[model samples]
Target: MGFDTATTTLLRAILDEVCESISRHETGVRAHVASKILEAATKGEKTPDGLKQIGRAALSEAPTMWR
Candidate 1:
């Protein structure tokens, strides 16, 4: 499903905030976080706080090359 401009912006902002501590080169981690956030959003979670929570949890559980 396609999101509206505002929702897309909100999701992007949440992704950036969640991945702030990670390197920009870490696409796997970023993708993981994005997927989680998108999943939540598609499931009717449009709230920033809720999406942030899900994004953070995804970040923590993200796969790392070193792991």
Candidate 2:
């Protein structure tokens, strides 16, 4: 009920192609844009193992004001 299989499959394939173009990243600091592909494949709101680390730093972790 979370990962869109169709999207994940397509994205995963794209990541494969991209990695081929850059085996030894010279000075790049970015991960594969399709990292979501892996996340969706592994995690699904229920699991957190394969979740992409992208944007995670910006995600709000503070508790809500719903006391």
Q: Per-residue lDDT tens digits of candidate 1, residues 14-59?
A: 9999888988888888998999999999999999999999999998
Mind giving the per-residue lDDT tens digits that candidate 2 earns over 1-67? 3447765565545454444434444213124334444555445422332233332321222122311
Candidate 2 lDDT at 21 equals 39
Best by lDDT: 1
The 0-to-1 C-alpha lDDT of every candidate, in the order given, reads: 0.92, 0.38
Q: Which regions in candidate 1 have their CA more than 4 angstroms from the true location? A: none
Using all chains and alpha carbons, the TM-scores for the candidates as numbered come to 0.94, 0.32
